[model samples]
Target: MSRVVATTTLWRPTGPEELALVEASGWAAWPPRLPEQPIFYPVLNEDYAIRIARDWNVPASGVGYVTRFEVEADYLARYPVQQAGGRTILELWVPAEDLQEFNQHIVGPIEVVHEFRPQA
Candidate 1:
């Protein structure tokens, strides 16, 4: 089955380091696995992104970034969304090994939507 992805999709609340890689690589992928980061997470909505940026990243790292991009939505159907921590936060978790396939699914370049940096 084909899923028609909207003209745009949302990826969000990225830390500065990760954001740099995404900007450089041209697509978002799962970061290297550590005990802390076991999966690659890409968010699917703005509300969730905002929550992460404001409530999580800013408090934790003092900065967050949201990126917008066009992906082959049909390919996204292969992955399942995981909801945790609370409602309103929905994201896809791509396993580390499967990340290549995930990256392949992205249709084009990624663009930054908003940068959340708290003034010190």
Candidate 2:
């Protein structure tokens, strides 16, 4: 018999460059963080993801994308949820060193759910 695993949905706001790398991974994993980046933050709510993609990413990179994926709930329990700002701005901070293991816990393909681009 097969066992069912519990999963938690998470969203990440990313720019064109990072999205490209994600696609290059066949949508199965997130790219490794740059040396200066110490934490990989995946937000818990879509609204916050959307806001960051539209407001922060677009302005910085000319385009922004929101990707959603599910991770094993049990694996994710190791990290505490952090409040970045208001109550709804919740996120999970995965240390950069743990990203590889974190990626392994993803339940399925990472999907691009929304896109933002600068207005002409």
Candidate 3:
């Protein structure tokens, strides 16, 4: 018999370098955060992710991608959703140390849902 897995959808805004790393993982995991990055944050809404990817990442990198994935709900329960600014700007802050374990809880392959590039 098959069992149902509870999952919560999350979105991440990323640049080409990071996206390449994720692709190298066969879309199964997020690459480890850099030494300066103490936390890995995944947003709770697509709109917020889009804003960051378009307004921030694209300007910085020339290209940005919005990725969507699912994480096992039970594993994610330990981290409370944070409101960065307003009600819609919600995200989960997972410590860099815990990212490996967090990656393991991802329900399936990550997918790029949107891409933003500088207007030429």
Candidate 4:
């Protein structure tokens, strides 16, 4: 069966002080919602794609490869679940044969966290 790998990048204010400021400003919602998990909104530029391809060791053409992104069960359980906010994590499904190749470029700081295989 084929499998899908989900990836995401997490960004936060640079320092605790910044975080405090963000909180104190009242701009930040109190008792943050569970579904408010961060989202990776890639601009999808040629150069960015190339970098991703290089990092994954796949050919540059692989950059535009479309992959489905969804939230994992655990994540849903932990965070407030909501369909809005593109906050769900990124996901990708690839043939089993391509798994190794994908893995080479996926694992690490990018947060390639889940493996989903189709049921027979």
Candidate 5:
């Protein structure tokens, strides 16, 4: 018998410094969420990730990164996709404490799909 696996994509927008740190860490998991952060929000699509990586990260940090990874659809069933700011923006809000577990569900290493460096 054959089986099919369902996968869902997730994206994270990060600053170059953080991206470098993540890459150095051997492409395993994202850094631990900050103390005050209630949820670790991973955007649903590349477009939103790029917007943040450019409009936000570039001006503030001089460079931005967009990471892409897939997780089992069943594993992510508990969380709901949220629309914020507008129709094009959607993301998953995973509680900070559950982040490590979330990372475990990721099928493979995270890939930096896009990089944006501010030109001076």
Candidate 6:
């Protein structure tokens, strides 16, 4: 039987220092293999989301596919500005079959974001 695995991450614009740090780290670039993009949403906090993405080795674009689960109303109140901007909670659906493989390899969501190019 297939089970749904939720991978999450926080995606905000990278600051200058963070960008520089990434460049200085000299990490190797990897080809995208995941069938879907990474998904970001309100249901998962930045910490949890980041953890899941790394665990799954999801690409930046693929991260868009992560779905929001168990989001609360009070959480919405915290983001009044986003609501004013008409930004609803974003969610992505990944096939349950893919979850196991991702969980096995990805240590966290930051690792997933690391795979994505800044411009791409």
Ranking by TM-score: 3, 2, 5, 1, 6, 4
The CA lDDT of each predicted structure is 0.71, 0.96, 0.98, 0.30, 0.87, 0.33
lDDT minimum window of 10 residues, candidate 1: 26-35
Cα lDDT tens digits for candidate 5, 1-120? 856778898999998776777788688787778898889889997899999999999899988889998888999999999998789799999999898898788877889988888776
Query: In model 3, what are the clashing residue pairs, if there are any?
Result: none
lDDT score at residue 83, model 4, on the 0-100 scale: 35
Q: Model 3 segments beyond 4 Å from truth?
A: none
Off by more than 4 A, model 4: 1-90, 107-120
Give the higher-lDDT candidate: 1 or 3: 3
Top candidate, metric lDDT: 3
Compute the lDDT of residue 46 as modeled in candidate 1. Answer: 82
Clashes of 5: 0
Per-residue error for 84 in candidate 1, Å, reads 2.7
Off by over 4 Å in 6: 1-5, 21-84, 88-120
Can you give the TM-score per candidate against the true fold? 0.76, 0.97, 0.98, 0.18, 0.90, 0.21
Candidate 2: segments with Cα more than 4 A from true spot: none
Query: How many collisions between residues are there in candidate 1?
Result: 0
- Model 3, residue 33: distance off in Å is 0.6
Query: Going through the candidates in order, what is the number of backbone clashes in each?
Result: 0, 0, 0, 6, 0, 25
Model 6 C-alpha lDDT per residue in residues 82-117, reported as the tens digit of each score: 321223333333234543332333223232233322
Cα lDDT of model 3 by residue, 7-61, tens digit: 9999999999999999999999999999999999999999999999999999999
lDDT of 3: 0.98
